[model samples]
Target: MIGAALLVFGLTLVLLLSIHAAEARHPQADFAAPLSYREAQAVVVAAQAREAHLRTVVSQPLGSVNPELLPRMQTIYFPQTGHHLSNRSGFLDFWRANGQLQSFGYPLTEEIVEHGRIVQYFERARFELHAEYIGTPQQVQLGLLGREILEKQGVPPRLDEAQREGRYFPETGHTLWGRFRSFWERRDGMQLYGMPLSEVVEEDGRSVQYFERAKFIYFPEELPAVFRSLQHSYGYPLNALYEVQLSDLGRLLAEQRGINLAPVPQLEGTHTWHPALWERRVEISIGEQWLSAYEGDLLVFRAPVATGRDGFNTPVGDYAVYYKTPMQTMSGCMAGECWNVPHVPWAQYIVGGVALHGTYWHNNHGTGIRPSHGCINLRLEDAQWLYEWTSLGTPVKVRY
Candidate 1:
């Protein structure tokens, strides 16, 4: 009986030791077991909860007019941050590849049509989709935000040593060749023109360069007679001289930014107009530097005027006041002569970009110095009077 009892105790002890050995091998609950359906579902739901943090962008229609032209929906993914964005179409990829993710950030809104062109706004940049340039190299382009910003600040980018000596600015990607290199250097490079704001843009069949204070155009094919002769005699490149004319861009630029650099003087009250004011007419003599405003041949106002100088001669023709603004910003440049006058008050655009406006820069209106680029310059009060008196479509005759 004692032997049998001892045998039973030894077997029990061995069983206890085996159980301890198995527990030591595992040390914890067995995780290798296949999860049940409920457990698997919980795991999946947790993963989805994490992914739900990614932003989902939605694209809205620019308008009902061109639904067929709308871009198909697309989602963008940033693997590094595990952030997702949608509705950017190819712009997201383009932005990523072009290093605009940090500079421009994400899209503020879906693509929309602006000024008859498809455009998308980002934080620091505006992406213009030139559908008209489909299949061309310019299908996508950046707006002149940098230029507009610089013009607003009245401070442009600084130039490097090469740019100071009149070379293409490295900041402009070197596409804007030093077309006005010598001219810009000779005519006060930094203090006068600021830096080149834009690359050479083809507008109205001519290449144009926008400077902070001026605009220069390229007329390579048709050089003016004087410049043509200079090209023949002195081997001067007319391509860089006569063909390149100064353009008036201040008012237009200001309009684009929706901020007036020059505010018009507000009249105390609306002035009563004379019945004859409806028949107001203006006459300018380029050679005499004179302007005369008349009502039915009865002189209403006469003022000494400054016309365009030499190469920037005022156009001699018949025109009418198509548009009149209270204030305008005038800017132009060509060769060695350039002018960027901001906040010009009392402007009446006669034809093209030429206007009769107040001139605060110089007091020599009646003087023989025809310092104006093309527009006629008047004294402050005279221009204000004319601006108030003149009517749109008023006939203007500019001669000699």
Candidate 2:
């Protein structure tokens, strides 16, 4: 009986020892134990460093045009604003293609990760990178800085719904009237400035209306004294101020955040060409009956065009606009056909007697039915816009 009892005690001691050995080899996690303050700070620093490295890798151009050539990115430096724009996070391209300095102001910060997305601040805009749309043009988007600013200042009491007039927008419960509406339509405001956030309200002795992207302020006295002096010095039109001007909300916000405005040295990807950097070019596709206008390589406008039909085909060649007039009387006879056209609006002579002119007589443009007698026919509005957009010596290409 004593030997049996001693054997049981020995077995129990062995089992306890085995359990401790197993625990030493594979210990349980101490999830409840808090990290030390120093350890926690080190973890945060490591995470930030990793994010910065990832951003750098993403900003780099993927491949070169040739194995021998190094991949080149594009960066633009604004001397006036002492700011540089890197092609990081698609900011530089968007800025150039959109409105450049006029619409977005200068870059206030380099691309930085904000709320799990990359963003860069401009004087008047905040560009957010949508990684999901990386390859598309919509990858970068403008933040609702206008709306945000208005909210912080305390949004004015909502206007009575019944009293709203002049091109009302139900989306934002705002009315766009007077010169503001005209400017909005002319400038393609929906894409540029976004929806109006408030009706015209007096703020700091100025009439202002807030939009999702911008704040429009009415200049009752027309061009301010500073602008008038600039106009006089530069021979610029005073009306360019347009009675209503965009407030410098971008700059305002950047200052509020205490962002570093000092300019940095131009980066390695400093020299690359984009459509915005080139002269205006127009291409006419004879086969497609289409006209496309480009600023450098960027296609800014396109419209249907009626080229010469059959034997009176449009001369397919590269030409430059040597002469242009808003209104002209075109009288010509070709291939047993005579046309005595009166008041040909927006006539731009490209080669010999062949010109691009507004056609009121025919509505068939891009219907594959070319009816013009050698001249390229365009709709009145299209012709007018093209006429105003192009200057003398602008390149024009007519291709089959």
Candidate 3:
């Protein structure tokens, strides 16, 4: 009887140990046991989920027609607002996102399921939202005319519900986006682009009375969502310059200030530069003492600047504006400390980190003094002017 009891106890102990060992070896012991259905479903579901996310991320949100993409079926007739959406100006309420499967196509790779249950699911999309940019000024002009400008003269300037056809912006002086606003405030224009020259009464009778031509450029993500708000449309109005020669905002100001106006083809004597993305473009002429600004393909602004101790000889190379602090604590070998100077509402990334900005400490800007720590210095007003005149991405070229 004693031996029989012992044998039974030993058998029970062995069984329990074996069970514990098996449990430890199980892969899903930390969580739940994997169901046969779950394994299979996860494979397909995961693939579908990945596909959905990719298409969604690539496609533009369906708010307005993307001027560059093909119209999808989901983006059929726009704006069920009892108004016909024009294909030319692309007038519509919502430019629906084009994530819908254009046609039945096999996904590159989807989830692989080992069981019937869902491990993951992902659905691939065939097409994406159209990029509908209004490149031509004529088409854009007609669209703006269709949607009459709603001028809300309030504390915060805005253009409510005034849809942009190809492109639209109000003349607001508060900001630096003068290029678009320059076109929107025109008294008379055939089209914002491709318009022939015509006669017009100049505010300054001394300046040319002929109306300057117009131009339009299309960029997918040039402006941000906040700036695109209609309310801030009129905040950044044109300075003394934006009125006359709209395309080249600087020309209007130069003419108004009676500043020495360089002829349009200033490139005749010099090389006309075409800009590229993030190009290191700061042109410095030691002989002429001028600083030129370019934002990609456009020559935005140019001015004269003073360099270093004529000895440290400000290193000249193609550079971008890197650091833009409004009031910086400037320290140098010669100039002890410049406590405050209005520097950056805008500074382009050019070279390693140095940039061309304003100086309040030194009033004498163009007198040719070398009191700077390698950074080119401009007058406060000139600096402010340049600050408000460029995009953050503009290139500054400083070639000796």
Candidate 4:
């Protein structure tokens, strides 16, 4: 096996050297240009900087590229293209020059073996995704979701209010049209996929979290296009598309290339899970509310207790399971009435000092809609079992 690998390596070296020498003779062929002493010195500096930039991209899971692939690439590959590759700087230069499936990260044939660089089926040329979605990663989701929504249900024409002059409504009226007058006028007709823009947020005003961190994937959104249209009346596809989140897909492909994931995502540990490994996560609807908890992703224990009757509503947010104490004492009342309560062994999650433990004074466990100072109260034994089973950094997903 070693001998065979050596032969392949030697052959590849010869091929690449021949390409370079031949290109130098021709003065221009692949990517680099001729170098005088000044240009050579500049090339050396530029090469180092370009390498640093590719290292950055390798470090991140952008699009379908993997984080693990970054380390392998850094260790194995050497940078040659210094300047004259598109005038972008740093990571942007790497992206413009070498990171595409069609351009630099060229797809490899079976005969070609990349010792460290990411060699995949992807041709390194056709990566136009970067050009289309550049400002923020969120745009990828919007573009994909919008196209999916449109494909499933065709675009409705803009709305026309009969009351407005010079604006006409079609006889079929597929699109709910609005007047193009003032910003405030008839703007109500335009909606995202079918949901009114006003209802984009919940009553409490927390922007809806589309990506669920525990699963490292986007929570499935309903098929707005299919559900609303006659084209999808039978609903052939369950969801408009089996959409993968921008980060998740990239992380998945990186793993396939024998890449070494960083600190938290190490291999051969007591617990090692990548976002790509999960098949499906179950969504548990405990009460009238929907909150997600993955089976292997987290451990859950429920308890009930008394809460504020009036002003002190418990704010909801995501937190990590920090510590679980066997027995602790609760002294000072939240209402400023001091009382030392002993024998409270709470399972604590340190997202704003909240806990899930047994309540000695109250029997109702997270259901009667009673308010407390944000700590969950449960029976003593359940608390013990949960504390035993849960690992540090396990997430607690609580929503109503």
Candidate 5:
């Protein structure tokens, strides 16, 4: 009887040891085990609950939008997409500042948290919130969805050498050719899309190419029916069937993550929304030595300028930009003072012998140190931006 009881106890001990050894091999055995139908449902329900909580956290207004920009933050509803962009998040301003419809396309999802950062999705782009750059122009940045998508599929092998027929970027051993080349050159491709990562490849039965920041798909067929109707209704050219169209990577990635993209109603009690108030105009404050450029009511650019000193005051009146040149040799003699400067960059002649040009001679702007002869002087970059932003007959107003 004693031997029998000992044998039974030893067997039980060995069985328990075997079970522990199996568990040690697979540490996550409990978690890896096939869950029951009800357990799986519960897991999904918990995930959905977490997502709902995050959505609430992101949607609640943080009171972060600048008060001055509140007017421009008016909620905009896109009837075609059935989506509304709320101004509370300051996305509308960023969207408008950047190329709105042309660059980002329509909004795909409202502001949401992804990867511990607040973000929103547009049709072709993703907008990420950079709280570190808040109150600055770099507050909103574009996510690298193109690179991310390519990474998921494994990065393509780069070419050994750049091709000779088209624009070749030796940086990535990729060539931009054909319709893609035309589109890249026409649009601010380098700045907007970054470098091409791969040559054209077949993706989902379409000719597609990947860039560092964007994906382009060639659509040879006629414009979609909705776009055709928009072309007729809005008078904008929505017919780019022959051209390479940007893929809706933002929408695609959001869908892959099972994000909710249902359209929400327009927020109540917001200011009236306006579209494309592009009336390029410049205003100079002589007393403050400041210049402001406006597109309709939207203040696009502003900088300190060195106006004329006592006798050579920048004339306080309304003038139009009648002439522009990339570089000029400005030579003039006024009141016994003579200056013969060469290679003066970005000269936009607004008045007689008085132009808005960059000054490398002195940094005494925004103060009455050493002012200009009779013109307005600006920093090299500011002058360049203003030069590009203005055109012949752009209105310029000088005030005290």
Candidate 6:
């Protein structure tokens, strides 16, 4: 009788140990970032280990009899938690119709009736249904729950409607339109800008619009055909095009906002560059008085510069940084008079004798002051930075 009892105890102990080993090998499952198809499979597998009968049920396709769970709606069941969540009917349809995962994430709570409206919660969004069908596309709308919730938690709220709509530009008396309008819309209109803070105006001779998040300047010359349409739409006269085309308004606007939107690039800890690297180019905006370096489509560096004086217009066209010198003496002549500049630094020759170089001669690099003799002049430090960042044969584009 004693031996039989001991044998039973040993068998029970072995069974418990085996169960613990199995649990250690296959742990409980939870989604970290989000549930992908493969991740959902792993979660199901873990659940099956916990309940053998669940294997047969999991093998069957995840189906829903609910009419709302159609089109893009997907029903997901979590065996670990024994809870099911779904993108069903109204809220799911609204989310897909609007922005889906881009605007709002998957649902967190089931649809609940609140204040005579159906509501649901998502990771980053909240949805509410209205029968009146007054605003947005569908009867469903995104609640400003995030803003309200944050404000209750002592966080600052976003700008109000008055602040967002922005004032008009007193100089031009224009509003946003054309390429500027298109770019703004594409970049997420109200979400980014809230509203135009001011009317379209000229800060320092450039067409500009101030928004809550950013400032946009119009460059008509960059796209002439498009500008023609813009000019026609805005009813701008032919005479004003030249003045609007050449101004340092973007840089000045950025400075007023206290932001460095034109970020410089660094090559340290990067991969190698080849023949196509020289294909990178630089652009000098005569109106904005700004020079921008680009690697392919990416803007890498930007700085202020002084271009050629009145009569000696810095020829605007395509050129290349063909030659470079750390220090040199630049000499030129106009009619009967001759002039010489000595100890110039970081010279990168562009066209003929004209070059982009560092000027210790003056401190008015980006002050909209023109003091150079037909050469693009930079502050000493800016010149040095450009010298190190650029290479021979880099294309140069000078635009008005």
Highest TM-score against the true fold, candidate: 2
Global lDDT scores for all candidate models: 0.53, 0.66, 0.33, 0.32, 0.66, 0.51
2 versus 4: better lDDT goes to: 2
In order of listing, the candidates' clash counts read: 1, 4, 64, 22, 0, 17
Candidate 3 stretches greater than 4 Å from native: 1-280, 334-355, 367-369, 385-395
How are the candidates ranked when ordered by lDDT, highest leading?
2, 5, 1, 6, 3, 4
Question: Roughly what TM-score does model 2 have, to 2 decimal places?
Answer: 0.55
| Candidate 1, lDDT over the whole model | 0.53
In candidate 3 the C-alpha lDDT for residue 234 amounts to 38
RMSD of each: 35.3, 27.8, 26.1, 25.3, 29.5, 26.1
How high is the lDDT of residue 252 in model 5? 88
Instruction: Please write out the lDDT profile of model 4 over residues 209-293, one tens digit for every residue.
Output: 1111101122234223422243244332222211211222223333454443332222211111122222212222334322233
Instruction: Return whichever of 3 and 6 wins on lDDT.
Output: 6
Better of 4 and 5 by TM-score: 5
lDDT of 2: 0.66
Clashing residue pairs found in predicted model 5: none
Error of 4 at 96 (Å): 48
lDDT for 291 in candidate 4 is: 29
- What TM-scores do the predictions have? 0.32, 0.55, 0.30, 0.27, 0.45, 0.33
Instruction: Say which prediction, candidate 2 or candidate 3, comes out ahead on lDDT.
Output: 2
Candidate 4 local Cα displacement, residue 5, angstroms:
30
Candidate 3: tens digits of C-alpha lDDT, residues 1-400: 7997687557534533432343343212111222232332233234334433453443433343454444432122212111112122221111111111111111211111213321111111111112243353222221111111112111222333343343222332122123433333332333322222222212333222111223223231333333234215434321222222322322332233344422221211111111121132346775566766543333444565776554435555432233344443443233233323322223322332244655444434556666655556664434555665443333344455
